[model samples]
Target chain A: GAGVSQSPSNKVTEKGKDVELRCDPISGHTALYWYRQSLGQGLEFLIYFQGNSAPDKSGLPSDRFSAERTGGSVSTLTIQRTQQEDSAVYLCASSPRASSGSNEQFFGPGTRLTVL
Target chain B: SQQGEEDPQALSIQEGENATMNCSYKTSINNLQWYRQNSGRGLVHLILIRSNEREKHSGRLRVTLDTSKKSSSLLITASRAADTASYFCARRYSGAGSYQLTFGKGTKLSVIP
Candidate 1:
C-alpha cells in the first residue's frame, strides 16, 4: 500500500492570493493532521481530523487558515489571502486511529509554498 | 517536561562519533516520539516511547524517557554521515490537545565525514 501523498510539490504565489494544498491519506486511516514549518516559526500544528468527529482547529494560526477532510480520506488546506509569513513547507500525516498520538504517523512529501 | 526548544540547536560531529539530543516538556504526556527530517521536508519517525516505558532501542538508536523529570533523550550510536538531519521530539499531551503531537524546535545534526 502507498503512504500518504500530497499534491503540488511546490507552489509560488503572490501575497494576498489564495492557495489550496491537497493530501491523500493512506486508506483506512482514521486520523489526519496538518503542520507547517518555516524558518522563523519552526513547526506549527495547523489542524486535525479524526473519524467523524468535528475537526480540531485549535492549532490554526488564524481564521484565514482552514482545512477540510472529506470522506475521511482526502484533505485540503486552504489559505485565504495568504501572507508572506505563510511561506513554508506544509506537511500532512495520517495514523491508523485516533489514539491521541499513541499511534505512529506516516507523513507525506509535503507541499512547499512560497508567498512573494 | 518542557516543550519549548531543543538544546544545542545545531551540532556538528564526526561520522564515527555519537550524537545525543534532549527534549523536556512542561506538560504531562502519554508518549513521546523522535523524528528525522531531511531538506526540511517530511519527517521520518525514528522511535516512540510510551509513558509507562523507561527506555527503548532500535538498531543503533536508543531512547530514554524520564516521566518524573519530564524529559526524554535520543542517542544515536556510532553515527554516519548519512545520519545528518534535523531531529525533533514530539510529545503527546495527556489531556486536552492530545489529538495532535506538540513538536520541539528540533536539533540540527551535521555529521562530518
Candidate 2:
C-alpha cells in the first residue's frame, strides 16, 4: 500500500562533487524511472529500468548520469562530477508494468539537489 | 525533446469556475496522461486517455484526445481553491523500444476562493 519514496528529500553539494539519490518503488512494481525538472526546462526523462535491465538510457544527458536497479526493486541515480547545470529536482516513479494496459506511474516526493 | 506543449502558460479563475488546459504533441502517441504538481513537489497522476478514446471522465476531470490533431485537452468542472497548481500532459509514444512518457511545459492554474 505504500507509494514510491526517495531519500534525502533535499541535497546541497558543491560543484565537481558526486551525488547519489535513492528511490524505493512501490511493492510489486516492475518498472522504475528517473527524471529531472529544471526551471523553465520542464520534466526531462533521464533513465528507465524494467526489472533488472535498463533498456533505455538515451535520455540521460551525459556520461555523468547513471542509474542502476538491483533485485528488480530499488534504484539509485548517481551524478558524477556534478555541475551547476545539474541542479534540479530529481524525480522517481514506478509502475506496475511497462505494458500499454498499465501505463500509470506513481511518483515520489523527489530529491531537490542544489549545486553551489 | 518535450513531446507535449501546454497553452495559456497561466490561468486564474474564481472558485467554482471551470478550468481548461490544452496539450499539443508532435508525434502519434499510445496514451496521454495528465498530472498535477503542487508548488515544487512531486507530480500526482490525474488521469490517462488511450489513443483510441475520444473522451474520458474521472470525477470532475474530463479529458479529450484527438489523434488526428495530435493534441489533448483537460477540463476541470467546478474547480476549487485547492485545485490551484501546475498541470502537465505527458505522452506515451506509439512505438516499441521507446515507451518513455514525455511531459510538457505545464500550465500554472490559480484558483481564487
Candidate 3:
C-alpha cells in the first residue's frame, strides 16, 4: 500500500563531490525509473530498470551519472564529480509490469540536490 | 531532446473555473500521459490516453488526443485551489527498446480561491 520512497530529501554538495540518491519501489513493482528536474532542463529521464534485465541508461546525460537496482527493489543513482549543472530534483517511480499498456507509474517525493 | 511543448507557460484561474492546457508533439506515440507536480516535487499521475482514442475522462479531468495533428489537450473542470501545480505531458513512443519518455516543459497553473 505504501508508495515509492526516496531518501535524503535534500542534499547539498560541493563541486567535484559525489552524491547518491536512493529509491525504494512499491511492493510487487517490476519497473523502476529515475528522472531529473531542473529549471534549465525541465524534466528528463535518467535510467530505467525492469525485472532482471539490463537497465536502460541511455537517458543519462553523462558518464558521471549511473544507477543500479539490487534485488529488483531498491535503486541507487550515483553522480560522480558533481557539477553545478547537476543541481536538480531527482525523482523515482515504479509501476506494475503488464503487457496491456495500462501500467501507470507511481512517484516518490524526490530528493533535491544542490551542487555548489 | 524534448518531444512536445505546452502553450501558456503559466496560467492563473479562479476557483471553480476550468483550466485547459495544450501539448503538441513532433512524432507518433503509443500513448500520452498527464502528470501534476506540486511545489516542484515528484509528479503525480493524472491520466493517460492512447493515440487511437480521441478522448478520455477521469473525474474532473478530461484528456483529448488528436493523432492526426500530433497533439493533446488536458482540461480540468471546476478547478479548485488544490489543483494549483505544474502539469506535464509525456509521450511514449512505439518501441520496445526505447523505454525513454519525452516530456514537455509543462504548464504552471495557479487556481485562486
Best by TM-score: 2
Task: List, residue by residue over B1-113, the lDDT tens digit for candidate 3.
Answer: 43778877999999999999999988778888999989989889999998789999999999999998888999999999999999998887776754556788899999999
lDDT tens digits, residue span A1-116, model 1: 99999999999999999999999999999999999999733478889999999999988999999999898899999999999989999999999997744678889999999999
Model 1 chain B: worst 10 consecutive residues (lDDT sum): B1-10
What does candidate 1's lDDT look like per residue over B1-113, in tens digits? 34635667888999999999998889788889999998888899999999999999999999999989888899999999999999998888787667678888899999999
Model 2 lDDT per residue over B55-87, tens place: 999999999999999999999999999999999
Q: After superposition, how far is residue A15 of candidate 3 from its true place, in Å?
A: 1.2
Fnat of every candidate, listed in order: 0.65, 0.72, 0.60
Model 2: runs farther than 4 Å from truth?
Answer: none
Task: List the candidate 3 regions with Cα displacement exceeding 4 Å.
Answer: A98-100
How well does candidate 3 score on lDDT at residue A69? 98
Specify the poorest-scoring 10-residue window by lDDT in model 2 chain B.
Answer: B93-102
lDDT top scorer: 2
Error of 2 at A11 (Å): 0.1
Better of 1 and 3 by TM-score: 1
